[model samples]
Target: MKKQYKRFRLRTVSAMVAMAFVANAWAVDPFTVRDIRVEGLQRVEPGTIFASLPFRIGEQYNDEKGSAAIRALFGLGLFKDVRLEVNGDVLVVIVEERPTVADVEFAGSREFDKDVLKKALREIGLTEGRPYDQSLADRAEQELKRQYINKSLYGAEIVTTVTPIERNRVNLTFTVTEGEPARIKEIRVVGNKAFSESTLRGLFDLDTGGMLSWYTKSDRYSRAKLTADMEALRSYYLSRGYLEFRIDSTQVAISPNKQDITITVNVTEGERYVVSAVRLDGNYLGKEDEFKSLVTIKPGEAYNADKVAETTKAFNDYFGNFGYAFANVEARPEIDRANNRVAFVLVAEPSRRAYVRRVNIAGNNRTRDEVIRREFRQFEASWYDADKIKRSRDRVDRLGYFKEVNIETSDVPGAPDQVDLTITIVEKPTGSLQLGAGFSSAEKLALSFSVKQENAFGTGNYLGVEVNTSKYNRTIAFSSVNPYFTPDGVSRAVDVYYRTSRPYEDQGGNYQIATAGAGLRFGIPFSELDTVFFGGALERTEIKPGTNIPAAYLAYAERFGYKSVSVPLSIGWGRDDRDSAIAPTSGRYQRVAGEVGVAGDTRYVRSNYQLQQYIPLNKQFTLAFNGELGWGKGLGGQAFPVFKHFYSGGLGSVRGFDQGTLGPKDVTGSTIGGPKKITMNAEVITPFPGAGNDRSLRMFGFIDAGNVYGENEKFRLSELRASVGVGLSWISPIGPLRIAAAHPIRKFPGDRIQRMQFQIGTSF
Candidate 1:
């Protein structure tokens, strides 16, 4: 019976095909020589239909041409049904146009914005004003669901509604039911014998919901995150002498409700092997000694994958420094099962030398090409030196005008010894409007605002205006800097400022000091990380007399008059190599500055030196230290200017004392800043609780010791005030913020202590 039915089905298909051929032959004959007419087009133009027709007016038409015309019109995606008819010799082309999408809307979607959903649909050809089909609507629903799945919304449901409107148009509404996102309920690590399960799980960023899970989202299950976590797990073992460590399998299981997930990582921690021997086995360009020095793998120590990888990378980079762009360096291991040891053979291959054919820059929509090109150390038509290319990339990154910078090397076609360098950069907004406020014990409320353009007009210049209003101090300043002033890496800067300072405690005495100055400076690049600066400034200071003025200020006014003018020469040197300017993990920074009052009413010299160092202890901890020293002395038989003294005991110095209130005092019991200053700070920083390894949010414990001394007083350890505190540092949207609550370990009589303080734009 089955065989008979199959024969009948084949006969039916053949009969249908024969009928179609006969009907096509009858409908279209070989005659044409007349005009054509189109029917059933509302939005699409008649010319569009005529353009797609295979046969034109006054042309012979046949059955093959009629079939081709129907196919061509349908291929345009504008028509749903196309028919060709013949009335005598006048050809009639009829089409039913697809509905035009009038609008796209979303409802009941909280995980994504309406515009975001629209954009996602548009990428898949389902936007408004385009032809609509049932298949397209079905695809839009699947795409929306996929987007939600990425957000861990496994139970999300999308229902597409197609509403027919007037003029053969339709409205597409994607109503989304975004259910609760799936949370990670547990993480299990199997086959880790040397470490506890909890310890192994702690290495992963995905965790069972923590108290702060809402912000970190670490409790969400993500395939990408799970992959990264597995890599970390493998690295941890390999770095600790488990030479044959590997991840066997990773299983992510979702609950029946799709609201909870469990992740299990199975790993194999093989035998721990020690290094037995290391040998060089390949061509080293007759510089074996030089290449051997770059090996970081210890012969007698436990086998470390990190050290092995470092050695190989160093060899490759060294080879690239000599124009060998295609150098291959590999470390092959020989395992000794009985002795539990491994031997490494370093193999090196330096391919043909290459020169840069062209250096291309891209993605700088606003910045000029020259602005980025000038920073490159590796130029076109030069030998490809990897070191120089790396330096060039770093230089452009330090410009602070780009959010991302990448360099790619590609071989030029048909050229064996030539390559092209493409430097792609993602530019960021260089203009900023900053509004800051800080609260401290002494300076109760302080407000600051600044407008700055780091890359003004894409000329690699800086222009800024700053204003500060505090109860004890007020300032307004304007500054401009040209980084390429003379084209030899020389920088020129100009500054104009006005400032007023008063005592923290008013006490009905409005005695104040007003100063105004303007300066021009030039910086000469001594090296890649060092700069020397020299400048001259003209300044005027006026001391307004009132009740309860400090005796030192009164004496200075009596000696040099109430108003004084000075022209000071300034010289400074700075060097910074920190990994990050905002959140440093490792590096050192130093600065030395001095001012000499060569021709002024105040004939004194002042100098200051500061050093900061950041040491990364591990993946999650950093140790930082900062120290500053300042000194001023009378010169030409004149006392140091009272207004030029250094002040300590603030957010940037000792934290447990009031701002600028840890120094000598006047007879009226007001804090008077001194000419000598010393500050030392040390902190241990770690990730904030439940934040995983995010460095932007962190907590720290700090120890601060510093003091200010009168010019006549000697530097003594007993006079140094010390404090221990815990602080929070966050790279917030506004700026870097720090909050500290400290307890002074040592305090003297009449010392003003402020235990809690918070401020912006400070790091310690």
Candidate 2:
């Protein structure tokens, strides 16, 4: 009976205690506030805290209002903690403010630049002077890790340290350990039936390390490069008639140490297809036969996706010629599964013709808008023609002021038939300062330099100055060109130069020539691919007597005087259709120029014609041929001037022979004036081995033949010297670089040979 009574008493006490606790937790009483006070703020003002409170100085305060004020104040992200204290007729608010970020620093960051990392962090709301939070620091570390991973730096580690500085601030220091980039150890291509594994892997830019891995960097594992390689592999098969080919899966695996990687690509190669027939199914605007002529796909040939794509593009371009800016051309293949043959039907939809509403030039931050706009052939409010638009883009690109140029057409709102053409360009530095030095056994140490500005002061005018300090060759030259000298794109160039050519380094030559000249040239556009040039120059030549002057030079000086003044006139015609000035793939260029000394002590006529053709055999191979013919004749029974002679043999003429050493030599072992010259070059060009698809660097095997004929000698094939060699060409940062190793196939007894030659800055 006593134990039961004690249990009943304990239960009653527990119930009473629980009821008191519930009332204290959920119950609140309404009160009227007389005043409000805020404390514990370093930078934030008291008014800011007061405004954040739900209840004002004289407003009524209740449990809901108190909860709202607390919530609102915390949402500002300014305070680390907040508290509320109530005294009789007074409300006190106390808060702990979050520290501001004082400074952000980076250490051991080699892969990514410090400014780059800071900028990225700033984008994620982690800049200095902002409120610092631990969660934000964690997020920043993760973000940096993600960036490193994209660069294939799997072993990279980021450690963020936060240190409290003076005046309620903290400094963030991100210490990074970026290890070596992951390398591609293996690449396995599975289920390729038509092509061998090695052949398929050859199409990829990412591969196992090779002998030239340091240069090509193909051994590195890059996600972006891998994606591009996959696309190339697909194109290779698609262009080779495997229309149904598909990549089933791709797996990229990293080793435990994060230093090695392997890629596995599984693909299904379907049956090869042949083109049974090709039909055009669109209104070619009364030019069906013309469009048909543009088709490169033959009916009896194998199905080539490239040919089909080309045909479709040709149809679209043809439609665009008729003012169809929104042309839709598609090649729909009709597959015959049983016979393994495909028939392609080209369908075109030429929507309403569009007139250009506006021609906009964008991304010309450094260049003037007029500079880019003047290159446009398609005008505002004119009919849209694809060919003209393409030409405009190419013209702007050819200016060499931009790294990239793109054109986009947008349909004007509420005007379905009108479109706005926007030309976008990425500007590059047009000013160049080149300083170079070279050494050779014969030429000794030579120093050369030039300062050039293609777009001087954003005016699209070229200015250049060159100086050579070589012991054998000393020159000073100044040149300028104004491309917009005339409204019709006629260019004008002015040049002034002083040159002294000596035959001996010790200044022991019997004779030396000093020339001071100035010329003005103008280029008149005759057509899209042709130009006519006219120029005149006045030159003063002084022959300095020395020890071992050639007999011919002495005789001429005696008859014409040591000092002679000549007025030369020049006229020329040129055409250029090559794709790139630095690396031409397919096109033909021809030029013919003639110069005559009409009013001077020396009277002569000199003419030269040059032709170049580049033929693309495939994406990887090219055949280039160059031929030149030069002739000179003296007027009024005088011999051709010694300095005006044409000499061959060198890097620019015939390799394997010494420079200007291929003509007839006098008794003093010096090459004299020549009346006739002929030179020819044939090259089989290919992409550099292991550099895969890099057009900037290429390799070629060349055959060169050239010879100079003296005044009495006639042009003959037997007199021509020949050479065969392998060479390399690279478009370097400053200019084009070429190197050649040659062997003379046909040479005379006294022919001087220079088997290895290199040039730093010159065009192909």
Candidate 3:
């Protein structure tokens, strides 16, 4: 429109000039003498035109300057074009304007969503019904293509189709084509020294074949997998004594098909060193002997960095126990190159003797922090006690509420001589219940039951009932434990029980006996994890002399009293840190109980002691050992108590033996009471998911060695009964279900058959 107006005005101006030229023959010099006049501009006001012109009215009307002024006015984007006319001292400027845009629209764009497509077009400044351009339309198509590529659509195509509409306008539609995503087809591992190809392949999440591979995203070539694979490789070597090793380089190669990936890791293996000696290097403030006592490493041993680190830690801890919160210990090594040995030099520095600023407990979701805090001996604003911190860790660990307990220390910010301790924990189920049923040979068609709530009602209290029934006799019991019996941390317990069972007779005969008892027990802490308990019980026992009953038992019972009522006082000491109540991997537990018939009218005093300890054979295996000793002697010419007699060859007592059919046999071939018995067992536990690390809820192979002899028989290791087998167990709501198919490795002649047994809830 602007160009057309310019042509029209040029014609008019030329015509006027031509006519003036004709009228001014021989007087051309007179044209510039008259006044200038303007015409044909509605918006281009005359005052605006004069302001735009470089020449004044009195100046020469040169065509170059006059035309330049008109071009400048049209370029303001305010005018479509400006026309100039020069007619005998008259200048005319005519302008035509362009139309404005109102709105823009899109249709059928689902691939890139409308908003994103709109943004793509806005980059080129195209929107609404704004003044459109062919250049912006072309650029918009390219911009949309770039966006699609980012979504992995390398084969994507974009087309912008413009439609002309009413009043010199058009509509633009960006059409796109999105292609399929590329999938990885294969993966390969390279440069493995510590393991085989199949082993290494098993370590990687990425794999070559399987229908479910796509769901697991195992076929995707990812840097994350590569990094994790490297770590796995590193751990495998480190665990095998390849400590000084490094992964030199790694390469990820994509196949020509672009769907397969191959990874290669190059590693460097360094020399393995042995520890020759350890010597302290730093000033111990003339207390070298005291610090030296903390060293635990042996001189002529393989280099165990862990032990050295532990020794240094012990030194630091000892300092902290004496109010030095910032004690530091560093282990420096001097290599004996010629002898292929390494010597360690220990250094200790006490940076500061600081006080405790705060002690915070964290990561306890179910247990209250106060419950744990009460166990601490270290107080805020008091001198930091490393010993207390360790004790605190032990206290929390002993609670059986966490899988791991860790303490993190940091200097109180802006406080030079203050420290804050954070106890971070990984909470576990402190409460456990096992409900199960099983059958055994000795206890034919037996049903074992137990209901124990370790953390009863979420308060860390305990209550339980346990019963084992057989054709012979059934025993029922009820027990309660208040972990925090008193505000001062003493523990209290109550137990009530009744048992009625026919004593299994071998040769003579079988008979029935019934017994009931009640007791109150109180515990005082000997240490954070140790406790001493004292209790008194009133027990009544009635013995029905059987034809199979050992002559000695009957003879003694006749003198003790047909139905005896006795009150007994018992004292016991227990300390347990094993990870589990039934089975432990890395912890130890001990129990010793003895009772004397002080208050009871019985003529005998009876006592028993059982000690158990657990040690980890590996991350997945635990070794457990146990021993038992018991004795009952006549008092005031009276007989021993029948209910407290020792019985063995059961699920908990012996793996392959039948329940309650073990002990000293009567003269009539009945296995009767024994004055004492001893037992031992070893187990290897493995994991089965859906169950936590409760030893009772795992699959394991075990070797049990022990036997129950007569009460008067001497304990000897050579006479121990040994049983070996694989067992399966899991926690049920009623009790632990443990089924072991065992073979008695060593059994005496005429011993009862105990090939396989299923026992629910047995503790060793």
Per-residue lDDT of candidate 3, residues 541-607 (tens digit): 8887655566656765776665878888889888877676755577777788878887665756667
Q: How well does each candidate superpose onto the true structure, as a TM-score?
A: 0.92, 0.86, 0.62
Answer with 1 or 2, whichever has the higher lDDT: 1
Ten contiguous residues minimizing lDDT sum, candidate 2: 3-12
Backbone clash tally for model 3?
23
Question: Best candidate per lDDT, number?
Answer: 1
Candidate 1: residue pairs that collide: none
In every candidate, how many clashes are there?
0, 4, 23
Per-residue error for 648 in candidate 1, Å, reads 1.3
What does candidate 2 score on TM?
A: 0.86
Q: Supply candidate 1's per-residue lDDT for 79.
A: 73
Score candidate 3 by lDDT: 0.68
Give one digit per residue, the lDDT tens place, for model 1 in 647-712: 888689999888778888878687778889999999999988898877888999999999999989
How much is 710 displaced in model 2, in angstroms? Answer: 1.8
- lDDT score for residue 330 of model 3: 90
